[model samples]
Target: MTVESRRLDGNAAAGRLADVFAFDATVARTRCGGCGTTAPLGAHHVYADAPGMVVRCLVCEAVVLRIVRTPGHTWLDMSGTAALDIPDGDPS
Candidate 1:
C-alpha cells in the first residue's frame, strides 16, 4: 500500500498505548532497528485504523512497532525496534 494509506498520527495510538504504558507513549523515544534512526514516537508513522496498530519508521518505511489486542490480552511486537525509552515520569 502507499504511504498515504498507512498514514496516521501518533495521537491515534493513545488508547492502544494506554494498555501498556503509564505515560503518554507518543512522547517516548525509540530507536528504529530497520534504519537505526532514533526519534520521538510522535514522529513515527502510526496506523491505528487497521486490524491492529502499526508504527513505521519515517526514514525507511519499515515497521517499528505493532500492537494487537486479543480478547484475553494485548500483544505488542517490537521486532523492528532496537530500543524504546519510556521516560520515568515524576517520582511521585
Candidate 2:
C-alpha cells in the first residue's frame, strides 16, 4: 500500500495513546535510532491505520515505536528509539 494510505501525524494515534502514557506523549522527545535526530514525538509519522500504531522518525522514516494491544495485554516496542525523554511536570 502507498504511504499516504496508512500514515498520519502522531495525533492520530491518540485514540489509544492514553493507554500508553499518562501525560501528553505528543510533547515528549525521542531520538531516532536510525538517524540520531531528536524531535518531539508529535513531529513523527504515525500509522494508526495498521493493526497497531507505528511511530516513525521524520528525518529517517525509521520506525521509532510500535504499540499493539491484545485482549488482556498491551505491547510496546521501542527498538527504533535510541532515547526517550519525557520531561517533568509543568515548571509553572
| Model 2: CA > 4 A from native | none
Residue 81 in candidate 1 has what lDDT? 84
Q: After superposition, how far is residue 21 of candidate 2 from its true place, in Å?
A: 1.9
lDDT of 1 by residue, 1-92 (tens): 98698588766777788889879888888899988999878788887768888988978879988999989999999899899888878799
Candidate 1 local Cα displacement, residue 67, angstroms: 0.4
RMSD of each: 2.4, 1.9
Q: How do the residues 1-92 of candidate 2 rate in per-residue lDDT, one tens digit apiece?
A: 89776678877766566787997788789999999999988889998867888999988899999999999999999999999898897989
lDDT at 33 for candidate 2?
97
Measured with C-alpha atoms, the lDDT of residue 92 in candidate 1 is 90
lDDT for each candidate structure: 0.85, 0.86
Give the clash count for each candidate.
0, 0
* Position 63, candidate 1: lDDT: 95
Best by lDDT: 2
User: How far is 71's C-alpha from truth in model 2 (Å)?
Assistant: 0.8
